[model samples]
Target: MGSITVSGVGKAYKFYSSRWARLAEWLSPFHKRRHTLKWVLQDINVSIGQGESVGVLGVNGAGKSTLLKMITGTTQPTTGSISINGRMAALLELGMGFHPDFTGRQNVFMAGQLLGYQAGEIAELMPEIEAFAEIGDYIDQPVRVYSSGMQVRLAFSVATMKKPDILIVDEALSVGDAYFQAKCFQRINNFRQNGTTLLLVSHSPGDVVKHCDRAILLKGGRVAMDSSSREVTNRYLDELFGKPDEAPADAEASIPTDSAAAHGLSQHDDVFHSRPGYHPSEHRWGHGGASIIDFLVSTPDASYPSRIESNTQTEFYFTVRFDSDFDQVVPGFLLKTLEGIFLYGTNSYLSSRGTAHHSAQAGSVQTYRFSMPMALNEGHYLVSFGISSGDPRQDLVPLDRRYDSVLIHVGRDVQFWGIADLRATYQQLNA
Candidate 1:
């Protein structure tokens, strides 16, 4: 049996003039009504079977949240019907059912009841919930007195403790420390093992890979793609970081014959794809003496590869064309996460055991190729490459620094986080 079913769902909101205009209409009594309806979602059809894990992927303001809210029955769709089987729990937003003035413990009971748990049932699970929250005495304090992380802990515990047949999580995992996040993942894994259906919405590709079997990509309030987690994530990233001015190949052709409407449609398409992802050259760097002319990520066939698989080897090709040559030039590169966490770096001078010097004539193209292990956890990463030379301890001359040389996508496989996946083995103990 299906856990959730949404058929031909559509949602729209009415836009009206300001209060002053409404008051003027009230006074005039005969003023014609001026109102516009904005459609946020249209013809969204999807179904989730029992024990299935599905992910919703989209850029900001793509109506992902709206869809989830509709499915959870928090918001009604303008058209279409939704049927959900069994009890449902949703952690749509942090502190969603929480009162700022109420103690965390009190809110736990309220949220639990809202999730269909009886007060006696919640009391029985309170210990596990408290242990999971790990907030100690603060649990008795007002929610407003708790930190963001603490609030997340409390909400996550309460939502998960009820063990609903359907669980809808919307980016609730982004907060919290690493340890608690890992705990949350463990809980989610347990849920999967127990045949609980999960509907997840997250920007983190890694999470999608780990938790979701299938994913749906929403673009412009419509279902764009429905496929495996990896495929959906790739398409979402492509659209997210795609060039703003470049419309999809079919966009122009798909527009209607009306010139004005076609132009408006083109503009709308551009606006949707313009949402930022990991774009090279978007990185800001310190002033440098030299500039990176070009950098690229390519495959063995010299074709530029957009998406990458985990535990795979790839070649990074970069070229630094100098405007002017200087003595004792050191060229190097660093790979960083989209959030600016440095993953790995290497420099010619550092690896060469001595000063790697190169004198470039003006407008000279110097090429460097590195075959690095792709041990990245699946997500978007930035490649920054530049050249510098002088004293290691003192000031150095930076020739060129490119913030985003390339975007690397590391996908998830049966492996762990690290710079390299050695394909480790293990054995289980039996008691």
Candidate 2:
């Protein structure tokens, strides 16, 4: 059974220059009210089953937050109705219900009370909430004196303590540190296991893929697509980058027709793959005269492999189509962490003088291949490639520069965090 039913929900706001505009309208009997109305949402209908986790995805100004606000009763829809089956707790924004002048401990009581918890209940749960927040004595200080992260932690802990029947989170998890964010995910997962219905609004595709079974994509205040998380995410990204590619209607079927499949050509019916040539788009310039092109990741055997398992061997390939062939073409590629830190880089010219004299042909593709060691600690990483002649400043042509060139996932097997997965042998010394 659906725990929440939203039907024909719509919201609109009228914009006026000032009170004078309304006054002028009222003064003139012949004049009609000249107000510009913007529809924030229109005709949105969705049914969320009990214990179902649904993610809402959209670009900025797409009314995702507005829809959530309407559902939570923070704002009312201009038309239609929303029927929520049970008690709901919403974290639409960080510290939404918290008073800045109130201390963290005080805010806990205030928020809990607002959620219908009695004072005695809040008092009994205070220790656990405080421990989860991990804000220390700062909890005693006024919220106005706390950092944004502190406020978020306090609010999150207090909200989740009672475990409301319906939980609505809108990018609030992004406010905390990595560790805290992981903890929050764990708590949300636990809530899911206990049959709590969850609605998450976030920009991260990974979050939706990992947490939600279903997704709703909103575009221009309308439901663009309501389907599996993977399908919705792929469609959202395609729309985001103006990439004209369609995700398969049935993603579970044998054909893989998502963004990963668009870059490369597919041959087999069961598995789709990228073609052999290096093709990189979404180009930009980097430091000095360097460009990147056709940068892609693929398995040694598989034609096109974008997604890979943790601790798997793969090949990173890209072609540097230089602006001008130089006397010494120092071709290289960089492996970067998601934060833009250069984890590792190597160049053909630096490695050896064997290819130094060979000037690359302009308008011709120069291919470079590296055996990516299975030592990458998962998460998302980018591959950047460039060509420099002589000194980096003297003469050069940067053919390819692309962010998020390849998406890598290091699964649960790797226990470490950072750029590389250094398979180090630990020896316990007996004293």
Candidate 3:
């Protein structure tokens, strides 16, 4: 089987004092002295099974690249061993190992040879590579003239042409436009279905959780956690926000209504309210000082649970309580698909009426309401809301934030397709 085994692996580089010191270290084999070394990875042990997809996640300087470099043979580990049982292809840094003077065609041929393909083998794959790249006649031009996106296209096409037993995709995909990114993901999904062991390194938790079955979190040159993708991403986020506890038990509970509307939602609990299995604790983060006491989605017709048809008007109400005074308060909401792709969002700072910069005393409450048409197709969506202090368009700081706090389901007629319903019209024109 095509599998990878990394045992007690670590990588270190010599820390030379200066250019002359580096020269001295290089020539020191005759002098019996070595330069000081600093470790970037340490004691990393993991075994990836055949056909498994694993995500390597970490912040910058977390040794993720160092680990992948060792596995791909670009560099050697300072200690321990790495074992691979099959052919592999890697898309590491942008434009890595490509000659600036070489044309795209020449670079493809050279890369194929480096990956152990014969001239005839590369010739047989050229057509497919060209078709996938879609860079047109620029394929015959020097790679130095290519844009970042074009380079990624050619590099990705070359890396995936042979469908090697192992595939390693780094953050190169992040440079592509949205369309190319989608295409790359489709190809990766195809490889996964066809039993190619895949290793994906990315900073986006949504991408990791969507594509990988398991993940490893790295921090300070060591493995921080190894678990299912969702759990590992949760741990990673906790590290980013520096919070230890999950969202409060009543995070999804709406703000308490006064005597006027307190009983408004009692009758429709089974229909409009959040479905079972969705809780705020699943995805929520922010700083303290202000708390979102209640957040709810409702229809314009005054329905409490926010049950609505696609293309209908809806309203989102957020009630925030302040623990301290602030110079500016900005409230915002995000609409995301179940897969965590952000489809739409808006903040008070960008409203047409103009930005609102307001201050409040401690223990005061503010309620902000937004009215809009829901043009989404039939799907389950998550609502994320936040209250921030400072210019949201600038260096905004969150006072309180909750992600995936409310789950809403939209029902649509048979005509709509895809994410948004544009209410499009078509006419036949003939001569």
Candidate 4:
């Protein structure tokens, strides 16, 4: 009963440099073009049949969301058309179709009406929606106060309140907490099991691999690759890693081989500050007992880079000099988003599982190295390094701390929504 067909669809936006230009264009009798068209999508064609599951892959600004908006009839295509053979339901942008001032329950009725449900029909589904959303009293409160996670919970609950012939879900589901996302996906899987045609967008290739049988990847506003989920994901990953355009900001600048000697020297040069990933506004503090003087972050293919491709093995190294006896010291690091959201972090003490005790002697030098696969989604992240000493029971004394010290850009295929990239593959053992 469910099928979708998109024919030669393209979307373009007109840009005007100033209000005067727009006014002149509107006032002109000839209607001469004063604005240039910015094509977000071009000449797209796809046919998804009943009971089929597909994944849409794309980088940021690649018009993935726009394509979904068109298919869901939220916006008109500048050119071409989309057709759905049966009833369709979609979860697009987070909290879309929801009013910030409206209560979750109120929005449910309104959104359900827009989804083609009658008032009595929506009322019958209210209890099911509220139970699924599980936001307690907040369900009766204004949506504006709901956290991003809560909004997605309510949105997902409403979108999937009833089975439809076709269902489309996007990365907005990733906004929910891990536990709730699992619950949401379970419902999606249940819908798909009931012969619902599904189209999903995920930044994590593993998700596409696991959830979808066919996949399409968009590049520069065009369908660059379309094939089995495995094949398209492989191509997407390859294109991401080999990108010459993803170079660090320091690509245009270089340090001479002898420049280290020219400037200062072994007497102590600020090597960390010279690297391409170094952030100028890094906050530094802590006592003078120990100081972090140098650092290097590298992969097998590159070192001290401004950009690191996702899913590559990365190693972090930082040199700390103990000018005074720093007892029971433990080293640590943090990888956080620009907004200071903690993505991942670990200290040597935690790494050792509280079994190891460490102390630094005066005039001693220590370098800490941590290695892992950088599975972060495409974005800029800040890296911080710190060291401290104290018993595990309570407080600790900070020896040296660097906050938001290094800025790194990650280039990756969109799969899982945020930070950590999961590697998932699928094989049909039988059938």
Candidate 2, superposed: residue stretches over 4 Å from native: 17-19, 25-31, 246-325, 350-357, 361-380, 391-416, 423-431
- The residue pairs found clashing in candidate 4 are 203-414, 203-415, 203-416, 204-415, 204-416
Off by over 4 Å in 4: 242-431
lDDT of 3 at 310: 76
Ranking by TM-score: 1, 2, 3, 4
Candidate 2 local lDDT, residue 250: 27
Cα lDDT of model 1 overall? 0.74
- The TM-score of predicted model 2 comes to 0.76
Estimate, for each residue in 1-431, the C-alpha lDDT of model 4 and write its tens digit: 89999999999999998889999999999988899899999999999999899999987888899999999988899999898899999999899889999998899999999998999999999999999999999989999999999999999999998998999999998888878987987888898899999999988676777779999999999999889997887566545434343544433223322222222222244456755467778999997788887776667666555456788788777777788886688888899998999999988877778876878888776777667778888677899999887875578788889999987767654546657776778798986
lDDT of 3 by residue, 177-221 (tens): 878988998998998899999999997666787789999999999
Error of 2 at 56 (Å): 1.6
Clashing pairs in 3: 255-294
User: Weakest 10 consecutive residues, lDDT, candidate 2?
Assistant: 270-279
How much lDDT does candidate 4 score?
A: 0.81
Would you estimate the TM-scores of all the predictions?
Answer: 0.79, 0.76, 0.63, 0.62
Reference-based lDDT, residue 41, model 3: 94
Residues 128-239 of candidate 1: C-alpha lDDT, one tens digit per residue: 9999999999999999999888999999999999566888999877888878988987888888788889999998877887789999999999999999997887677677
lDDT of each: 0.74, 0.72, 0.78, 0.81
